[model samples]
Target: MRHFLYICLFISITINSQESIDATLIDSSNLNADQIIDIDNFETLYFIKDHTIYKNHSNKKSINYSNYQLGEITTANVFNPLKINLFYKDFNTVVILDNRLAEIFKIDFNTIQPYKNITQVSTGFDNTLWIFNIDFQQLELYDYKTNTTRFSAVPVQSDVLDLESDYNYCWLLTKNYLYQYNYFGSMISKIENTGFTEISKSNGHLILKKDNILYFKHKKKEEIQPVNLPKLLINQFLLTNETLYIYDLEKLHKYQLKIK
Candidate 1:
């Protein structure tokens, strides 16, 4: 009787584990991620997904890579005309890429005076770049042209997870919340988030990448729905009106969103 009970328990446990895995996979597979975000910005060298940067413009079997050697991709941004910023995990250096994807500048905090232990980055609005230095726990600005800083100020006493900027406001993501900063370092009203797993934005729309699904904020009463996808652990996401691109742990999934 004891042996029989053990066998029954083992069988039940195995079945439960398999069922859980199947449930997660089923939910992911049901998601038809058809919205393939067109990262082909004419001059775009490649699309950033799955902690790796690929030059999608290449038609040959060979492709270029911008792999993270530190640990994982910490932060990334592409600001028009041909400027890209890539920050690695636990590193004080950031790579600045120009239109040709060539290295233009490398900001190494170790060489700077008391600017070591850099943590976060924000790039947008004119030729400005915002940086968070752990040593001082303050926000600093860097000028792309002529390479100079005019001013900086701190708004919150917390670690920033993401940063988005426009002509009017700067969106700072900290932990589970998002904060807004005016151009002159004034606080704007906090935007309440419903459920966003991985968020990415452009000049047009705000993308909420949650779970195995993606949501686009449209009208006040209307929001885009979640599309199915393959089992994905998306660390980086990019979205457009017609396309949605999810970079998972091992592959890049493209979806064509149907807007009805």
Candidate 2:
């Protein structure tokens, strides 16, 4: 009788776990490590391999660009499909690329006035950039056109773990909390960190990872919803335009989200 009860309990837990998953596999491929950095809804893929940037379009053609002078690219932003931003943290510079991966403009922060120790950057509205000045522990709205600081927010109390932005809003994640700021550099909202290890945002929706579990939250929802992934081990992942891409053991898995 005891053995039968233990088996039943295990079965019940397995069924409940299977029911929580709300996703379908779309496609997958084997990708090299740290190669893919960003992917847009239009199927445009941005990757960094061998100290060079590669932009691949849906039509299967690709353009490669590199700058040995910048040393190495710390991060790349493909939020605006038309304008791509690359941050060279070592040199404190940003290179803006057009849709075809052509260099439109490059700004070196060391030469600018006020002397910003920029650690991260993202695309902002109307030819502006969302930048975090490590020296001030503040977020700044910088205009690439005139090479000026348009707006600067107050210093954050904690060290920023990651930063993201869209056209209208910017999201900053620290060790203890997450902060939201508008284009005008005003604090809009904040949420407790709650042990989130990774975060990705697109089209007003956010996907957070804590341990092996995933959470989904949108601007419209007050509470985050938990998600059960089919796979347990995730090396890296990204969420954008209703699609979830998970990379594990050199293989990329794409899943279409079916939110409840």
Candidate 3:
């Protein structure tokens, strides 16, 4: 009798369903990797591993190129045109590339040693890139042409969660708090509790993630709406238009999000 009751309880729990949470098991495609990065509006998918950039496109075809090392790719700048930014450590350097993955120019930060630390970086406009420097808690503007860095006073309160940017302001997350920073790294406004795990921008709005869920916030809206995301790992998530990409150990899965 005891064994029968145990089996029944297991069956009941297995059959139980939760309506509020919708989940679908997505198959793992033959995407070889421990991760994916640089999902941007620019269309091409670029991921770094073992000193190479594995690229895929609209046709579902994929290929790899010997480009930058994973350790050297301090950050991947997907926003730039047909190029990715390479940042290397212990050298205080930045490298830019062309569409064919050719090296264009390099910014040697060793020359700009005044800054205590380069906390963050992203692709910027007019032959320049954005830099977040810990020297004086400032958001720094670095010009590739002049090979110089300028500091703008912004509130660099110790607990910055995540950062994203357009040509204008910097979007950030901190313990569920969201903030917008101008080019000078000054906070323009405080947004709602986005629960944003990571942030990116396109079409004048902020794309955010909360607990493996995607949310979209228009410029003027006070709140963000939950987006339809396919089945993904609890600890990792990635999203783009129409397709949602998921990552886990040695596997990359792709799913089409059903939008209403």
1 versus 3: better lDDT goes to = 3
- Per residue, candidate 2 scores C-alpha lDDT tens digits across 1-260 of 99999999999987754554376889988777465678887877788887789987769878888999898888888888678899999999999998888899899899988688998798899899999999999889999888789999888888788888999999888878888898888898889998886788878888888888888886776577776567557776788878988888577889888865
Local error of candidate 3 at 65, Å?
6.1
Q: Tell me how candidate 3 scores on lDDT.
A: 0.61
Report how far off residue 214 is in candidate 3 (Å): 3.4
* lDDT: the better of candidates 1 and 2: 2
Candidate with top lDDT is 2
| Global fold similarity of model 2 (TM-score) | 0.88
Clash counts per candidate, in order, are 13, 0, 0
CA lDDT scores, all candidates in order: 0.57, 0.83, 0.61
Can you tell me which runs of candidate 3 are displaced by over 4 Å?
Answer: 1-28, 39-43, 58-70, 182-186, 192-195, 228-231, 234-244, 249-260
- TM-score attained by model 1: 0.62
Q: TM-score for every candidate vs. truth?
A: 0.62, 0.88, 0.70
Q: Model 3, poorest ten-residue lDDT window?
A: 16-25
Q: Which stretches of candidate 1 lie over 4 Å from their true place?
A: 1-38, 42-53, 58-73, 114-116, 135-138, 144-153, 166-169, 182-186, 193-197, 211-213, 218-235, 249-251, 257-260
1 or 2, which is superior by TM-score? 2
